[model samples]
Target chain A: QKEVEQDPGPLSVPEGAIVSLNCTYSNSAFQYFMWYRQYSRKGPELLMYTYSSGNKEDGRFTAQVDKSSKYISLFIRDSQPSDSATYLCAMIRDNYGQNFVFGPGTRLSVLP
Target chain B: DARVTQTPRHKVTEMGQEVTMRCQPILGHNTVFWYRQTMMQGLELLAYFRNRAPLDDSGMPKDRFSAEMPDATLATLKIQPSEPRDSAVYFCASGLTRQGRNEKLFFGSGTQLSVL
Candidate 1:
């Protein structure tokens, strides 16, 4: 099994709809979870970051981590067209300088 | 706003030619990472450096690829005799590893490479 896995979604949704993006990992050692957003022809930018097995909220985005299930999720509330992009989930072990394991990003399009 | 900078936003080279991608990491950030992104493989970590020393490069092909940090500000990835499969967007990211913990990463616009 891949270390990290995500549905490569070209998930389409109307503006203002709630979108939930999820990832599952095979490694139980992953401690830090992050979500990155990439626009067309642009580099990815950090969208949300969380360490613990709970939810972290920032404005319209919420990041949730569940260590027991080895699953993580990012929820976008009242999404906008500007939110249309590829969302990548990344995780890393607690070891110092450990490389991050990234999931195959899910492409999202919030249509108007 | 401080951000990582990469040169040659686009590169096209014939097979067997050498290609070098450069990155100027954010000043004061001690950690630098090089990643290659493709539709089939997603984002793959190629190499990384900490305090100008290579920390890990297991993901890279040692025979044809080499990464180095000449100074605190500059890092380079070179592919000698590039192949068509080497075509991918390469991104440089910098982060401050505080207390041995990897912090948030700031990525550059990336070098879109096409090896024909």
Candidate 2:
């Protein structure tokens, strides 16, 4: 199985709606979880970052991690058209930023 | 406004040619990473360096791929005898790696490569 796996979703949603993107991993060693957003033809940019299992909120975005289940999720509240992008989940095995792995990414589109 | 910069925003070369991609990391960032993004594979880490020394490159195909940090500010990834499968967007990311903290990576716009 892949180290990290996410549904490559072209999930369409209306503006102001809440969107949830998720990723599951087979490796329990992953300690740091991150969410990156990428626009078309652009590089992925860090959106949210969390360590271990809990929640980290940054403005309208929240990242959740469940180490027990090896799952991570990113939730966008009050989504906007500008929020349309591909969301990739990344994880690191340790504190040194080594053994980094990324998921397949889910493509999201928030329409007006 | 400081961001990682990548050169030759787009490159088109024939198969068997040598393709070199360059990156100018943000100043004061001690860690550099090279990644490739494709539709089939979302984003793959090719290699990474810490303090100008290569730490890991196992993700790269050593037969035709090589990465190096010649100086503090510059990093390069070269693919010799490039093949069609080598056509993918190459990205360079830079960050400050703390001893006990997670690093926040800043990625460049990426170099779109097309090997014909």
Candidate 3:
């Protein structure tokens, strides 16, 4: 099994809807989780970051990590068309110098 | 705002040719990363450096791919004898610290490479 597993969803939602993207990992060693947004033909931008378990909120976005279940999620509130992009979940065991494992990414489209 | 900068946003080269991409990390960032994105592979970490010292490159193919940090600000990734399969978007990201930690990454626009 892949170290990280995320549904490569082309999930479509109406604007202003709440969107939840999730990822599950097989490696319990992973201690840090991150969410990135990638627009078409552009680089991935860091959206939310969390360590271990619990939740971190930034304005309209929230990131949750469940170390026990090896699962993580990013919740978007009041989604906009500008939020339409690929959401990638990445995890690492330690510092930035170490290897990072990334999920396949879920493609989201927030339609107006 | 500080941001990672990449040059030659797009590159097209023939198979077997050498392709080099460059990046300038945000000032004072201690860590840099190289990643490749392909339709089938999604995103893969090719290599990374901490404080100008390479820490890991196991994800890269040693035969044709090489990554380096010549200085604190500059990082480069080279692919020699490139193949059509090597075509992908290469991204450079810089962070304040090393991996399993909480360091926000600032990424460049990326270099879209096409090996014909």
Best by lDDT: 1
lDDT of 3 by residue, A40-83 (tens): 98988989878878999999999999999989999999999999
After superposing candidate 3 on the true structure, give the runs of residues whose Cα lies further than 4 Å from its correct spot.
B98-102
Q: What are the candidates' C-alpha RMSDs?
A: 0.7, 1.3, 1.7
Winning candidate number (TM-score): 1
lDDT of 2 by residue, B16-49 (tens): 9999999999999999999999998878989999
Error of 1 at A86 (Å): 0.1
Q: Candidates' lDDT values, in order?
A: 0.95, 0.92, 0.90
Q: Could you report the DockQ of all the candidates, in the order they appear?
A: 0.88, 0.67, 0.62
After superposition, which runs of candidate 1 have C-alpha atoms over 4 Å from their true positions?
Answer: none
| Residue B100 lDDT, candidate 1, scale 0-100 | 93
lDDT of each residue in B1-116, candidate 1, tens digit only: 99999999999999999999999999999999999999999999999999999999999999999999998989999999899999999999999998898989889999999999
Residue A15's lDDT within candidate 1 is 99
Predicted structure 3: lDDT: 0.90
Ranking by lDDT: 1, 2, 3
lDDT of 3 at B28: 91
Q: Can you tell me which runs of candidate 2 are displaced by over 4 Å?
A: A95-97, B100-102
